[model samples]
Target: MTQARLRVYILSLFLIATGIAVSTFSAFSLAPLTFQVMGVYWLFSLLYYHLRINSRRGSTSVEYGINYNVSLILFTGPFGLYLFEAVYRLIGYLYKKKTKTDEPGEGVQTFYNVGSFVIQGTAAYYVYQWLIPWFEGNLVAFWVLLFLLVTVTAVVSDLFLLGVFSLLGDIRTRADVAAFLKERSILDMAKTAFSNGLLLLFLEQRNWTAIIGLFVLNYLVSQSYLVKAQSAQDKHERNKYEHMAYTDFLTGLHNRAYMELKMKELEKTKEAIGIVVADIDKFKSINDTYNHSVGDRVIQHFAAALKAKAGTDDILARSGGEEFTMFLRGRSFESCLALVEELRQQIESDAVEAEFQDQTSRIPYTASFGLYFFTEQEEVPIEKGYIYADQLLLESKQLGRNRITVSPGQQHESSLSTS
Candidate 1:
């Protein structure tokens, strides 16, 4: 392991040892009621473990078992809470091992969680004990104190996690700290505190039925929220993957696959369309002269220029390296020719900046284009038009690069009807 990982393991061990020492040295006693509460808490913890709701940000999660844990702290004090955490966390570790669900460093994580929970829970219990005398008679004050206790517990846990993350080099700057804090939801904290407050109130009244009913309702609500959140997460992942699949990694333009799909969709429509195939003039020479990186920048620059002039209904794609295609819809042959000519002129004037060996240079370049425009009355197949466009692009290059070649030359335009 690296030195950083070794240090983290050492820290985890130190905290675990500290927790065990404190729990052992402090006063401890057990009663029938303690056993009953421990049994119920274990059942709830196991259930929640299987149904944990992951937060939208970071590695934090929401589980109703937290309310029960707070209740345990209130009823049985530090010693009891520590005992429960030690056994429960060990069982969790073993279960993960058996199911082969444990990730790397899971053992260390389990120990760290046990130590942190003991420290946070024990501190909260002591604070509650110390402060109860000041608000013993006032129910409102007591409820507020419980809320504050929950807040303190949360703060302590956050601090512990932050410290560990800093040591792990996951957080290194002010911005990192700010982002970490941003991921923590104030509303979720409020909900946890409110639930803990209710649990403490029900415990004070010795209302077992109310406590059971509250937990049941909380579980159902949490499950419903989990389902909705999971559905939304799945949809987001699907869309992200779909976008990646259809996009060119270098230019961020639609790939050939997307262009093919668009063509198939347009084949069913009667729209007047223009198919254009364009290629960077001497792109291979550019790469050989500078480097592939400069060539990539040139391609990106060209794609951006085309994207800038494209209409909302127009389709532009990077069909392959140094080559692109466009589908201009609802345009007459003359309009399509004008647009292609304008694009050719713009590309000829534009230069891409390149850096090499601590030197910057503006690399001037040009592209050749071939456009084939057809009205709906002509009933030309899009596939055939694309082939013709590609052939014309080659013709432009052979006739001397950096120009636009179009079908039905200007001289023959009057012979054919326009869209």
Candidate 2:
């Protein structure tokens, strides 16, 4: 448990102790429900905070994440004290997803929400249960008015909270932590929960059956959210694994291993393949002058631009530093060569205005490519496919830095459809 939760637990214990002490000397019978709700809040709040850390991972939608956690806010007990903890967790989560850093005071609204809970819940507790009899001529009328007031308070507070939170519609699940965390100006989760919790006290106290129902409902819904999150994370992890193995991380392009993997996949399918290997022109000179960041940008910008020129079916992976390759999925040797030539021209002509968030100057960069096309007359293994592409890239570099070379293999049987 975090320090904050410990504080909440200690405070709750104090309240329970106070209530018990008060009941010992008076006719007032303390509601066991308050203690039960407080205990539940402590437990769930821990879980909610832990999940908040795990869910801020790559590409998870912020709206979906918030919605995913909403069931907890709805069914939780005690004027939604736990709901406020969820909000604090959410604040941290929003910060990580958007601004990419957890800046100080990023979740001030969350703390304020907790404060609101203390004021409102404490006030309502004293007013409805203690002060009502003093204001009424008849005790029955006092009880009725007290119930009505708490009910209205709960209803109005929930409506106002929903109204206020609706303004967070613009938030996206991007890496902008500071801005997202700071955007909320109104009621936070804690206050909302505390205010809403008033209604639960009027409703019949939940027994084992009700507890079971709440558990099952929350579990099913929360588990569904977890499953979706897990699925998205699984997909991302697979993609990331593939990228790590096959991509040049600095440039975000295919690495040497990627070329080998795709080649093997193609050879297994017995499809015609085009291998175009690319190299940055004057890459060493750029590295020498502007250092690695600019050099890194040159590679990244080139890869991004080249990737823009290719079809979705095409394979473009950075094979090594300043060297890259492309695999055209279902094209003939001749057509694939032609495609590489087009790509080579695009790389030469394209000027990347590589901007630095830290600097004002822009740098220009370019690269060359070699093309090799092959068919299934001979079985091509991963190693052979990669060596062939490497040779072609070397050939292109020897001819000139900014160029493409084609290695024509057996043309595969082409499919035709005429209606």
Whose TM-score is greatest here? 1
Score each candidate by Cα lDDT. Answer: 0.77, 0.54
lDDT of 1 at 140: 87
Q: For each candidate, give its TM-score against the true structure.
A: 0.87, 0.54
Report the C-alpha lDDT of model 1 over 209-298, residue by residue, as the tens digit.
887777777878877887898899899999999999999989889999999998889888967888889999999999999999888999
How many angstroms is residue 22 displaced in model 1 relative to the true structure, after the best TM-score fit?
Answer: 3.6
Put down candidate 2 lDDT per residue, 1-419, tens digits, no spaces: 34354345435543543443344334322367544554554544444443432312232212212211122222332334333444445655585568666544335434434443433343455455565456557746644554444444344334333323333333333434444445443333433333333324323355545544554455466667777888998999998886677657676666767666766677677776776677887888888877787788788777876687678988887777777777777776767766666665666556666545566556655555665565566565645766786786676567656665556543322221111
Q: Write down the TM-score for model 1.
A: 0.87
